[model samples]
Target: MKYSLFTELKSREVIDLFRSVFSESEGEAEGQVISDFVSSLLATTKPQDLIGCIAEENERVVGCVFFSRFTVPSGQAAFILSPVAVSTEVQGSGIGKELIGYGLDHLRSQDVNLAFTYGDPTYYSKMGFKQISENIVNAPFPLSQPIGWLAQSLDGQEIQAMAGPTQCVDALNDPGLW
Candidate 1:
């Protein structure tokens, strides 16, 4: 498998990968929701504020992940990982984790101080994320699953409490997505 940064040329393929994977694991409606969300993210977000990564094999996109610029009141450089997908056939092969790790490495090299994500704790814990409360750093929207709010300090320092609300890119600003 090959890991690389996402390019606009692969936009359709990446979106389809997310749609198909989510549709299988969740449902068709959920898949369409994710597909629309990714489409908006790719179209509306500024290049500097979005970073995407993909895993490919035999010239097909097998796994994909996206990290968009996240804003905190404290002005720390941060990003949020969301809506990750691994092709059903490759789910257990670590492609998702590897794609995420690759994205995080790129963020670190770019001087990002923190990384946040909302997902299953058991799964994200393997990638060094720890459950965090909104008191420490609020999510852009009120979370239906507060326990899924997770973060990791990329600079090896403890995550400090940031006062006021957090903001995600326009595409992720939907309340339903939380």
Candidate 2:
């Protein structure tokens, strides 16, 4: 098991990694969906979002996690993690935990304080993510993975309040995403 910076990810192999690891639920995705979901995931986005960190094993990407910058109602900045995936072949191996730990540490170093994601409470809860109703900042979609929408605070305390919609600013242009 190895952790790689998401920005270092490239090549056809990485795309294969995304597709293979995410295959289980692709059936629920629209027919127009493409694998380029990874293209714009970076800190370089207009609002400075975080890209995904991946876990590679035996020369293959087995796990993936990505974060995006967003504004809460109080105008404070936060990071929203989304679309984490680990291939069935590598499930229950602590790879996801390592990825989250890496991301949280990375965010902390950069002074990013808050994170939002929709995922399994049982799984993400262990990583400090909780279901906070008032501070919810969501993706463009209706949060298909209800159980996955979770939040965590790392470099700060209590999430800022929100009033308007929580969006990724430019996530709509990505062909790889839903």
Question: What TM-score, over all chains together, does every model reach?
Answer: 0.98, 0.75
Query: Residue 37 lDDT in model 1?
Result: 95
| lDDT per residue as tens, model 1, 1-178 | 8999999999999999989999999999999999999999999999999999999999999999999999999898999998799999979988888889999999999999999999999999999999999999999888999999999999999999988988999999999889
Which ten residues in a row are the worst by lDDT in model 1? Answer: 90-99
1-178 in candidate 2: lDDT tens per residue? 8887675534455555656656555652421132445543432465356556778888777877777776665565577776577777778888889898887888787887777775578878888888766435544455445565677777567765556765664653342342
Weakest lDDT window of 10 consecutive positions for candidate 2: 27-36
Badly placed stretches (over 4 Å) of model 1 are none
Residue pairs that clash (backbone atoms under 3 angstroms), model 1: none
lDDT agreement with native, every candidate: 0.94, 0.65
Error of 2 at 7 (Å): 2.3
lDDT of 1 at 59: 98
